[model samples]
Target: MKSFLVGIVLGLFAFKCISSLYVKVLKPQSTKTGPERALLVAPGAYIKGEAYEPLGLQIRETCDFQLWVVLLLDFFDNIVNPLQLGEAVNKAIQSLKDEGFTDGSPVFLAGHSLGGTMVAMHGKNHYKDLSGVLLYAAYLTKGNKLSDYPVPVLTLSGDLDGLTRITRIMDTFQELYEDVSSNMKAKYRTPVLVMEGVNHGQFASGKMPSNVAEHDLPPDVTNVTAYQKIARYTCSFISNIASSSALSQQVLDEGFNTTFRLLEPLARVKALETNGFSHWTELAQKYIIELQNKTQISVRGIEENGQMIKFEFLFPKAEVHNSAVAITTYSLVTYPLDPFDVTLNPLSPIQIQAKMLSQERAKHVLPNGRYGAGNITCKDINQLSILEAFQNSSDVARERFSKRGRQIYLDEDQIVESSVQWQATQLRLSDGSDGLHVSSIKYKLPFDPIQESKSGLFYCALLSPFRAMEWIYVDSMRLKS
Candidate 1:
């Protein structure tokens, strides 16, 4: 027992020494001449900054942002001299300036995990001098305001990150996502992206033995693919931030166009990968509750008891605030399904029950359809067609909204809402890791479903703020007698 105890202590001491030594041995990157823009990258606790080389390399391929990898020795430095990390900010800026980067030149700060926290904390004092912030798998601590959000902030996180879960990232910036659309002036004010099938440590290229603490790891997506997507989103955000209004649109168009070109080949591979109908269907059912976009939207089970429709949606995970499943039920005769034409009108618009539910309350959803997790105020609304819900949607959004998403048969004039009373209870996410388990979601109790039109119904997609890269749609659902 004495020997075992000595061995454990010796092992810990050796690890502590070895970690510090690793940071010292890393060589600093040589400066590039006449760099267009500057980006200073920092690493998490106990992580070497060089681990982000692959991501930086990918980012530089598209954007002109010069990468200045900070040699932040967190494991030892954080323990012995934490203030050194903070002091390095001014030094890093001066270093950039010395390397021919001017005061007017676009300069950005980026950090991952704990390093991100430190960079965010720096915002309370020096955010006015910076152009923007790139936080990966991390969120700003409460009470830290970054230039009243004038600094274009992009928080890119992984959906499967266990150390810092995606839900926490959403909750941390719930205020930003929930704010009225008009008030959101700076397009890049807050765009929180959750990459599918990515884990916490995956953000950094080098995999170290230290990553064992990360939980709920991804079952799919290689690190290379994840980094490629990450770099693409990062590049787009940086380029847009640096561009003028007209130029920004061009940048977005190019980025989206690039994604469109890859979809054809990705679709072919996806088809081959998911060969069996049974396998695809099983994945589809699970995705509906998970907020993925699918080809069809099928309710796991739907019951029509009087005016109230109760659904057996599985469940949601634990988060800083709450979780919800957004269901788009479409009543349709349906046209040919096209992958490239998603933004186009799928068919006819579906009408919602006269009363109120999630969609009707919040007329225009955020870009990613995020109306932050909470009770959608249910009010007594007159018979409203799905088209009316998007009354405030932008011209671009309207093009899609006009004929997109919604599908439910039965005429809007045929709803027969006379003497109708409205009642709405927000759909809730139950507690714990039991998200895979089933739960009841009751949101409306007033408008009756057109009984005769039930069979022709084709639900569109189940979107959750916790969305994956792939979309999941329910092809169809059965009517309960």
Candidate 2:
């Protein structure tokens, strides 16, 4: 009887303990008995005498969703080599795996600044178990290598950070993307996003700076006012590639009737500006106008005629002497329409045929999330079926995610853009937070004219947190056109 009583009490105590882990620590499913689900790595950028313990605790708390540890690199005292930093992350991950903490839940490798750079260069390749990697304010000193990482990488940067040249880093990523595409000979690539308004220090919520506007935050925009907004978007992004439902309802609404018009060809894609926004709408308008004015193409004009909807495009008459019918048709399809309606069916036979041809062209080119193709080529212009371009990097970024696999977030568009023969590089707007404003700017066209002409499309993707802040203009002309 005494033994039975003791056993019952012990069992109850164990149950209580399990309840605490789930209810308090694990929260959602502490009752399930299995290996610990996830792990988190912290940034040890300035870990010195007074900073170590508190920052370590901060990181552990930040990553409470999964089992986590802080890697105390001597970066503060001795600027460690990136390779060494990579190895340290590997060791820590291995330790967790050794402790039998490996289950189906994800193992996250995350870091800040230099630490973020380390993960991008080494984490997924060295630590195979990492499910997802979140890099905050990190630059790729060396471009990302290892094509078969089996992990998703989420790279976040601030619009106005000077410490890490975000634009240069983005350019480097494009180079890496090109290198990877050439080596793998693969059609698709991973995704990278430059989150606007986020500075380098805000990845963890508690340590946000006071001066900055609550909404205009770096990653740490987790004050009371922004918590709900922050958590919803952050969690959804982190949980997994967003469900189609999670996408902006407005964007999705616009997409229902629209088909995809891939920007570049197989293995040869163009650099897409994932972070540009504010001026993209205007640029789209300008491109449409140019197509209508400059080329003998059937450019559409969308307007609502009260109850009746009107979608009109003027096509060059099929006079054999004027131009080849196919050329004229192709020109019309590539031309952008003003205030285009995705739902409206093509009106004229020429428009219908152009739309069909555009759809067929899209089947061959790859898709990178952007609102409209900028600086497009004859080959790329000829190929697209859909006329629309993605508005946000996330649109393209999510496409590269892997399901039930190691790699979670990736977009290889940058890499493919590099291999093209006619590559163009332009100085872009810098976010204001960096304190260094671009009061003046300059870039000579034919950015990389010689090598870029071969592959058909030649363009550069300008990655800046403040890319959407202003109109991108050269001395006289707008850059997007």
Candidate 3:
């Protein structure tokens, strides 16, 4: 009788453990009502759904977004039956919809550790109605690469994700990135963020000491800072995807900046591979955390709409403590270049530009978690302001400019205005706290030319006084007469 009783107690414990993990769906406990957006999260293997509670709560406190986590009991879980998994996800989604979350609301899926893999598999297998996928501390198999994901995908992981190494992250991201078309690349550059001192388990809630999947390495970042960074990046990426705004092609240019130097790492896939990821992660743990800086800025993109050329610049902020440098001036400059098929230059390499887009000179200096925008227009007869001329260090680039300048009696050293009409305005989607201001400024150019001759390059040139001179290649002004 004693032995039978012991067996019953053991069985009860086993059932409780299974109950904690068996794909149970949980809504964040804060709100009785639904939110503007709904997020479904998956926790790592052997970890309960509660492991992701803190992330959900942190996200909930800032934005009106609902967070849910599901735990599936499997050993080293893989998305072998994605169709079945998709159905399970749909169940939770339907529950949200029933709670008045509705069909109009945007639904996002995030996964941590194995859960991260689940998110990718969902995207790969059935990306039907999803807005976007956020993979936290997750790596994708070649079979799971999101080459066909129609929406914006963020493959963010930590440098210290002991189980899901950054090397795998980079290798898989490059694989997926290169497979997409140029148009997709132009639209969504597939932003990747690797926070310093962060590891796999933190994306979920607690220490997760026994979850051996997350290598038992010491994370140097504090909980407040870590969650703040995760929530911040997640929000920004979602905002970008939802608005369908281009984050500037700065990553490909010489001046793209991220905390990890991914601006260049995106192209140099083999650099980290030379040494194992542990070496890289150990170094990244030493990086400092801050609140505000214009980490990314460039010409958003150039598009032709009827009689005008729409030119927009993307101004994105980074996490920091305070802002020291206030207003940075950027001159919107352009010069002619040859079309892709034929190699020819316009007669004059006249770098035409409108007046500089300067910040309002605020006390806080473009504060943390905010963007500034303003606009103005220039007519041909009103006389457009010459901010600065374009300069190329390459001998081949300089030779092309010099030859073209001589053909049209243009000065290589001066900013010359051609007969181009310009108009600028802005439409901002504002969201912030701490009484910070959000600014919107969009610059536009009418399809007016001295005459339509050849293709050109548009630039958001950081014309001096604040920092070193840098050219942000906005877009190739591929004109169609």
Candidate 4:
């Protein structure tokens, strides 16, 4: 009986030794194909390349794309030693390049969870070589810089993913979208797809995390169905990038409508929306207009109702003391007159002025766990008059305004055109104790504005508590006479 017990203990030890050796020395295999485009996939931590076999097969069957599953150092090492894992990814990519997957064809980097973060970090360095990046349930550090990466980025996250909240993912997306350079705007547009009712573990099809508490399971769709939809979008994104064409919004929207049942949470949307601007679409439109006006790029034409002439005036970027929680205001004011009168006399001069204001607030938690808040009004104000020009006008005018200390500078006086009552529409948001505010005045002139046709004005102001105040504005108005 003693000999038999000793033998059993020895057998268990031997099995453990062999398993450790297998995990430590295991290397990922390379799959070769003659396809023009190839997808290099990185697996999540503790998950082997075999776990992604089902996803890879789906990609092959549906899109006919080549797949390469990258392996890292063992699971234990990955959590502790990120550098070693990074080296493995680099070696795998280099091998793929040597094996006829040259830069001539598009190479896309894809990953799930930890794999997603690794590919993003790698793609930052190899952005020029890779066509695009796809991240699934990936981890994004707070204040992660997305502007440095120039290539197109596509992020997929589950709405109910507890590990990586959908709010954080969308916030990251907004940061990336805002940081896109003017030169790359035409070719690349970053789009995010949030799968409703899914969770973190479902991104991987075969093996799910044994600890269910860490995941947010979808009540409607099975894991298999979720993976199928993921594969479809992933393939479509890769195809679009390979063609060097802009991603098709129609295709993505259609897939989203068919696969996902819900939009982002209402509470998340409400947090970003200002009073009266209750819908996310309204905020999105405002940002879209601002981008178009700032970049001086207009892809769509304005509707002509044959009666009222309509155009947009864009203000400069505003500096917020609290970027995480701040209100954005966009106001449009138009002259009150007979629509026929302005149409008849197309050469009316417009005047523009800008002002800045500050406000403070205090809040405390009550004994009942409720909250109390109040605002402290400020008496400080600064104003400046901005110059304007019109198209077809030979004598173009330019003026510069500079402020020193608390002294405000006005290069020109306020020109009162016809006593024209203007209609004003504004979108504003206010939060916390301290905030900076700006107000602008604009008027139409007889001469055309000094910019390309269909261009608008953009103004930005910097009001910092620790530094001197700076006012900047960009006027790209080309008024038609």
lDDT by residue for model 4 (1-481), tens:
9999999998886554333321111122335344566666666766665566566656655554464433333434333123444455455566666664545667676777767877777777667767888887773444445555567667777654645555446556555435544433422345566665466667665555543233333323677776776776776777666663334445565544432223222223223222322222223223323322222211221211111223233222222232121223332221224332111111111111111111110001011122213111111111211111111111211122121111223222122332132213221111112221333222222212353221222211211111111111011111111
Clashes of each: 18, 37, 12, 21
Best by lDDT: 1
The numbered model that scores best in TM-score is 1
Higher-lDDT candidate among 1 and 2?
Answer: 1
What local lDDT score does residue 412 receive in model 2, on the 0 to 100 scale?
25
Candidate 2 Cα deviation (angstroms), residue 421: 31
- Please give, for residues 1-481, the per-residue lDDT of candidate 1 as tens digits: 9999999998887555444432212112344343456666777766667777776666665444454443444445433123454445556666656655556777777788777776666654566777788888777655544326557777777645655653345444444534424554333455566665566777776654344243324324787887787877776776667764455445444533332332222232223112212222223223322333332222222212222332222111111112233332311111224343111121111112111123222222212333334322211111121122234222422343233322322211111122121123221212122121111122332212353112211122211211111111100110111
Off by over 4 Å in 1: 1-35, 64-82, 102-104, 143-147, 172-174, 209-213, 245-481
lDDT of 3 by residue, 323-406 (tens): 333212223333234232111222111222222222222212333334423221122111111111223122322343333311
Taking the tens digit of each residue's C-alpha lDDT, what string does model 2 give over 1-481? 9999999998886554333220011122333342233434445344221232333344333322443343434442323335345545555555555655544455666566655666665665555656666665564344344245456554444433334433333443454456555753211123334433344444433443322222222232333323232223333334442222334333222221121211122111112211221222123223422332233223222211221111123221211223211111211111124242110111111111111112112212222212243444222221221122112223322232111111111112222323222122222223232121221111112223253212222222222212221111001111111
Query: Candidate 1 overall Cα lDDT vs. reference?
Result: 0.42
Candidate order by lDDT, decreasing, is 1, 3, 4, 2
Q: Model 2, residue 190: displacement in angstroms? A: 4.7
Greater TM-score among 2 and 4 belongs to 4
Which runs in model 4 stand beyond 4 Å of their true positions?
1-35, 64-81, 94-104, 145-147, 176-188, 210-213, 245-249, 253-269, 272-481
Candidates' TM-scores? 0.45, 0.36, 0.44, 0.44
